[model samples]
Target chain A: MQTEEEFRDFILNGHLYYIPHVTIDCAIFGYHAQQLKLLLIKHRNIDNWSLPGGYIKRAEKLLDAANRNIKDRTGIDNLFLQQFKTFGDPDRIQFDKFDKKKWLEDTGLPSWEGNWLINQTISVGFYAITDFSKTRLQTDFITEACAWFDINNLPPLEYDHDEMVQEAMHTMRLHLYHYPIGLNMLPEKFTLSEIHALYETLLGKKLDVSNFPKKLLALRLLKKLDEKRSIGAHRSPHLYSFDKEMYALALKEGLVLS
Target chain B: MQTEEEFRDFILNGHLYYIPHVTIDCAIFGYHAQQLKLLLIKHRNIDNWSLPGGYIKRAEKLLDAANRNIKDRTGIDNLFLQQFKTFGDPDRIQFDKFDKKKWLEDTGLPSWEGNWLINQTISVGFYAITDFSKTRLQTDFITEACAWFDINNLPPLEYDHDEMVQEAMHTMRLHLYHYPIGLNMLPEKFTLSEIHALYETLLGKKLDVSNFPKKLLALRLLKKLDEKRSIGAHRSPHLYSFDKEMYALALKEGLVLS
Candidate 1:
């Protein structure tokens, strides 16, 4: 929603153009310099931090809706987004902070309870990893501010978002074993040590350095390039790049790496 | 809906008591004696096989709604259920098989185009594995028949259910590696050979018997019982049982089994 009129229309008639009772929340993980961050937005009226999310358009597919929300916030395209879990507790949206009276006063609306926006909702949660340094965070009329927060230092979030983050983290960590990552988050050609560090950082633990690279290489998802990077007098590490076909296959059919 | 009045009320005013545009579909995979099957329900109005599913009540949690649907159809409780995926394609429900005219004629309902049930829907897909021999299939007013069909020999299903089954199967297979299973699917005391066979049947492929049991044992999720089951004089084999504590822990915190 762009203007007050659009917001009012959406609050009243969004059910006509958007699928009511179902929304999408995104956990955008950012990785850079071996540190992970999460993108959070401050709602304009509510003044609370939350995962960036929005309603699905009537004609849009679920993935398309998730992708649109991602693009609208991060100003980055082509990040690999995934649905982690859906939250649908009957009281999930109940909070004193909703403040229907405040909403009516702020928007010049006549009533609030019967509005399409005030119903029980079930939210589909999606998560994606992108290079933090590459994204330009954007905000909309309803979102006052958007920024990246260190994952471990996130403030108390609104509604059931804390639970959503925990589940997203769990699913994303499990997925690190099954799906190939670092497509856009890593350098085009990198050494084994670099990729090993990437996995260690994403998994948020110490992976056996000896075993991590070997497992990646064993998957045959990486192709060794003849070029080598010389870091010092006697150390030249061989660089490798992802084999596009194999990487795609791993993404689709999944792989086992532990 | 149990009667014509209830069905008519649901068609016209279900949005008042149900979450509009959201439904739940279950892929009930039944396993027994090295055979795998799926529980399917033939819709009375459409006269086509479909994964048993229903709308979520306004006051119900997602899992409770799923459990209610499962128990209503199969008379089984406490089976392990997992959410595989949520499907939301605009044309996913636009099948010619819905037969609005037939629904109106059969139920004495009014025009259906603007009915809440006629809107585009997003379905949360869940899957559960249960022993087929134990469940007593039950049918409600809308369900003409409920039965198990061999997984490999299933008839064409209705309304994006084929896609739901495919996704559910893929997730369930991947989960076998991450989560503990075979609590109800296997006997209380089973041999290594028997457990291995269960995995092979569920996976629909042969596992390295030598490695499969060893990997499972390495997780320490099972215990070796003192007694052995004697078949022939020299063919007796030691039996094993699940360490309930360890199995529950593994179920909560996923472990790498493959």
Candidate 2:
């Protein structure tokens, strides 16, 4: 594809205008159907999948590169993004195992471009939270397909992306212990049960149904709205929306929801 | 110095056997005299001070590199260390401001070494916590002196190291809110006021004298020892030490010290 050629040209001479040996990989996480999911892409003509990622421009901030990768792939903007960790293992590219010549032939890219891709890279890992239903996913020339896979059932990923995902999950779980991350995943207004469900999905464990709501309420980060939601054959539970001021206070004061 | 030549050779030919374009900068924090301090080293003939740091070996783990940096500088091992952030600005080395030719002339290195020194580099930031009384600081061939400066008063630093220190302080403060970082800085047995003073120093503000002790007690991380420390004119306060089991539980369950 012409787009692939343009990208190859960008990559071959990217060091002239961008930071060489550095890239940003985003572990874009979404919550849906009581399961945590990750946005991943399969490279064109390659049997492996990888996290949505791209190189950083010479003058761009690291976080901006992550945002650009997410926007280009998912068409989502202003998502909750945080830099969790940086992966700098020297053999991260694994050029010994990768068939760069075959890739160059399959993609019709110059050998220099293949060599560039095989060079040492230090990837900054960012984890983003977005509503799954709201994103419009699109694959670029480099990718054959874009899809969401359950975090619990991820496919074989490329490079050290699997480790990146695991680190992101560990960081998210640690963050959730003291921060109100459920606000980023849940609807604007919902019952305590819904928020608890989101936590269970992210933590991948069963929480005590009776004590969870009380612990959340103690933080005073949610405001009980007058409206209620009626579930099938169950009591109508009161809806609650995040109290922005209280949430800010909790962030400053630090809260333990677990 | 012969050490300088050896280090220069290591830098010039390091890429063939080590990871290139990536380095580590450590913000080694020590607590003493009811104040927080940072370990800094003044580079020989450079006039400017910098964080004690070094490059990662090709076959070394990123964290291992950080540990090696700490050990090489302070002659301390097994300190509490964590990676906080990474600085990947393309202009990080500031070659335009640095006199590469003069450095080569002074250090008696070849032109290739000068070019390698002027190349762009991405630095991974690691913050380490240690007891001030324990470390035996030493200066290397690159540094004329190594000493601890109060966090409130730091000398003019090289590159973006000032920002790295600020970021590390911010991260350590945040870490202190939910974790028992005092364990690393405090003595084996200390009074409540000593621990409170440590928090006040790290947080850079005076805490409520009465409420701080109660808040720490609620976490149950510290056990009241059978001994007591008598003040000059005040009542003797009970001595306390970290309860290993409860400390582990607090780490897992998440404790909010604030």
lDDT agreement with native, every candidate:
0.85, 0.79
Q: Fill in the DockQ of model 2.
A: 0.37
State residue A66's C-alpha deviation in candidate 1, in Å. 1.0
What residue pairs are clashing in model 1? none
Report the C-alpha lDDT of model 1 over A130-211, residue by residue, as the tens digit. 9899888777666678899998899889889999999999899888988997887889999998888888888888999788
| Native contacts retained, all candidates in order | 0.70, 0.36
- Cα lDDT of model 2 by residue, A11-54, tens digit: 57766777667789999998876977999998877788999888
DockQ result, candidate 1: 0.79
Kindly list the per-residue Cα lDDT of model 1 for residues B131-163, writing each as its tens digit. 999988877666778999999999988889899
After TM-score superposition, what is the CA distance of residue B133 in candidate 1 from its true location, in Å? Answer: 0.7
Model 2, which residues run further than 4 Å from truth? A44-48, A91-108, A112-114, A177-200, A203-258, B45-47, B91-114, B205-220, B223-239, B243-258
Give the per-residue lDDT digits (tens) of candidate 2, residues B30-90: 8886877899988766778999887777777788888888788778787767778898776
